[model samples]
Target: MERTFVKDWRGVHKAALALILRCIADHGSPPSPAELQVATAAPSAETVQHMLQEMESRGLIFRDPGSGSILAAYPLSAVPTPHRVRLADGRQVQAMCAVDALGVALVFGQDTHISSRCRHCRADIEVSVVGERIGAYSPASAVVWYTPAAVHCAVAAEGQCPYINFFCSREHVKDWKRDLSAPRGQILPLERALDRARAVFNPMKGLGGGPS
Candidate 1:
């Protein structure tokens, strides 16, 4: 493994860790520095790379040579190849930006189309928050983590977001598309708890037996 000097940003950083987890949970991939740049509205690309390198060295993520982007630290399956995003409509839109950090900042990818799937993978590139969709067809969505049992729910669809209610199991999740006018952020505490748990997915398993 290529060893990189990493800085210690320790102990339950809700933002960074949440971003990392949200990336994989939703998009099936990690967010890159460039994506971070757009999401954070960074001044320059190099600044995003610098901070990203810091996170990478700390064993939270790995940089991919194929795309020159950051990927999750865990040994992942081959990126759900040819993953495409089909919109709510019958049209197949190209996806460029991918905001995976559940609910921090929006993450984007290399494709500039912003309306179609990436040429490389077909994962849903756009995301929507609240009633507004992020890319094109994404609806009010929230990635919720049910505590203890580790159930991860990432939903982007029409109707009210059932994830707002806190329940032990199955009540609200079954109704993800109910009441269209339900107040948002009602389930924020549940989201916060899930975001806090992202530290468990640390990328520092030691890059081994692969590209270095």
Candidate 2:
């Protein structure tokens, strides 16, 4: 297994970041800069924007170009991804990726309803997760595959592809791999996937841990 490490969150206020996350969990999105200034006691809206830019440079967050609002940071996203998780308490949120989708279940310790569509066929793939086991699956044969350590090359603008996904069958994944001509990822069981998400997104539990 590859090692996992937390990102450096310097030049960003830890309490401010924590408050932002708390707001997301409660409100489904980060508060606007003006609202944040009141909530976090930030110096000014301009200073908050500067702080956001610093966090973005460090890969700890992504902000909108026009409004400077947060698009995504770790477990949360303003724009939706393939993975959607619904908690038992009726709260719903989108995750950054598949791993983060399951991480939401682990972080909340709730029975979760996870849903995503097969990228190749556009067929709905859904699963219910109780603790670590799949409580139910629609097709009863769906499998998840993920790259353990997907690489990223900012200079060449390569290696930044979607790393995890569900497939109806191994044959579907085989067909999909013909385009990339790269090794496919290993199948991940539900429990292992959830554990991996916790390691990346919620490593510190009650303590404040920045995005991986």
Candidate 3:
């Protein structure tokens, strides 16, 4: 992990990317950095500029030159990974988590949903590519209790990828799904989502006696 991002990431040059990561951890995808600067009430223009440079040098993020927007990042791996747990409900969840390059975790998860994170980098300037992990079940494993609005999604009957099968309350899953658009809005690709869902999530060493 890069020390630059931690000590002075609240608002800096690439503040857009830092904000993006925070937003993604919570809402996933987000408004532009300009919009974020205004929203977060960043200190000064120079501060934002410096932060961007710092992020780029550290290789914590990727960026889009044209749009000047932050791409996704491994919040934990990029920063310091947070912890994930499995619950008795048979779902894996992380607390306000993010994945870094090595895949570190960050504690997140407020209410209803969590905020995701993204990074901005100087490399890959010619292209526009942006990107963007979690957990098992336990008494404390229930993340919905922390977020309150958590619903359930059914994972693989055999107990695979906790991200899709992470087990949100059906109502919560329905609520989260309702936010999607059209075909994508109604359906969730747990399997596909699993591909990107690794890092932060860890199934219980021994859990899940049945399937959903």
Candidate maximizing lDDT: 2
Candidate 2, residue 162: CA error in Å?
2.0
Q: How high is each candidate's TM-score?
A: 0.29, 0.72, 0.31
- Cα lDDT for residue 164, candidate 2: 71
Q: Per-residue lDDT for 85-120 in model 3, tens only?
A: 222223333322211111222222211122222111
Off by over 4 Å in 2: 1-14, 22-28, 132-134, 149-161, 181-184, 204-212
Model 1 has an lDDT value of 0.33
| Model 2 weakest 10-residue run by lDDT | 151-160
Q: Which one wins by TM-score: 1 or 2? A: 2
The numbered model that scores best in TM-score is 2
Cα error of candidate 3 at position 83, Å: 17
Better of 1 and 3 by lDDT: 1
> lDDT (CA) for every model shown?
0.33, 0.60, 0.32
Cα distance off (Å), candidate 3, residue 129: 28
For model 1, state the Cα shift of residue 85 in Å: 21
Error of 2 at 46 (Å): 4.0
How many clashing residue pairs are found in candidate 1? 18
